[model samples]
Target: MRKHLAFAGFATALLMLAPPAVASADKPEPRVSGSMSGTLPKEFGPWAGEPVKFTIDAHGRPAGVKGTFKVFHDRIDGSKPVGDFEGKITCLAVAGEVAVATGVITKGYVNILDKPTEDVTGKKVSFTVHDNGRDDRIFWIWEFMGAPVNDCQGTAPAFKPARGDFTIRG
Candidate 1:
């Protein structure tokens, strides 16, 4: 019984000398979390006369985000082509002024063809967000600087423009 007690005491001392299992407090802070989405106004140059909608769904604090872009034509008559885009994205916060995200479209479709998604699948799309520090009335928006469509297939819009703005009002 005395030997058993000594062995147990030694084991308890060893455990006290061992390192901790996790170090969560030593890790850096995670990125902010939320979703941002909105529609492009008619004056948006690239989609001047079309109704385009954009969405940026953040996967997590660091897995980046996935975006969905769509455009619809004046179609009570069903006489126009639709544009759709979906893929992964990476965003970087500016010097306290903006958050810029850019990535390639790797999925989704446009019109009757999947060309737009395929064309830009491996290509890059740049999106920018300007937060005026006010969440009152439509101030935080992500703007598209450039997203070109290449290697198109089937019946599709000849020009793929990527100059529109998206907003998340909360």
Candidate 2:
């Protein structure tokens, strides 16, 4: 009876520790997606509004990003979209509530003085998405205007939205 009791206690301890490892292994990676539209500095003329939609799935390994980055002048409002940039996001690096996604602009276009022009092609686009409720801010790399940060790493820029909504999940 004494030997049997000791074996049962050891078995119970083993059973208790076994499930957690299995449970953790079964955990799935968080999904990443967002719809963001915000404003940039007016001093940077010809381009004033920035809108990004991150709707993608398992890209390579850990995370994926797919979205359209568009820009419009402040005067246009809801009329038309200028600088429609669509591409595959190459890198998505996250820290806390902020995520920086970077990719090359496979295809893009802009309008110069109401004339459609093929511009901003083959350029790197990196943007930051903040997922902190009210404090949430949406912003991206303005390479033409010399944005401070590029690629999806380290500290990034966060621009408070003067309009639209941003939904980011990770």
Best by TM-score: 2
At residue 86, candidate 1 shows an lDDT of 60
Q: What TM-score would every model get versus the actual structure?
A: 0.41, 0.56
In model 1, state the lDDT of residue 70: 29
Query: What TM-score does structure 2 among the candidates reach?
Result: 0.56
The stretch of ten residues in a row with the least summed lDDT in candidate 1 is 149-158
lDDT of 1 by residue, 1-170 (tens): 99999999999999999997863655433222233333445555444455444455432233334333322233223455454556665543322334444545565434432333223345455444444433311122212324342221112112223433333321
lDDT of 2 by residue, 1-170 (tens): 99999999999999997856432444443333545445555644655544433332212224444444444333346545555656666676655576676666666665445675657666776667677776667556745434554556434455665544544444
State which candidate has the highest lDDT: 2
Spell out the clash pairs found in candidate 2. Answer: none
Instruction: State the TM-score for model 1.
Output: 0.41
Model 2 residue 166 lDDT?
45
Point out the worst 10-residue segment of candidate 2 by lDDT: 52-61
Per-residue error at 47 for model 2, in Å? 5.0
lDDT, candidate 1, at 145: 24
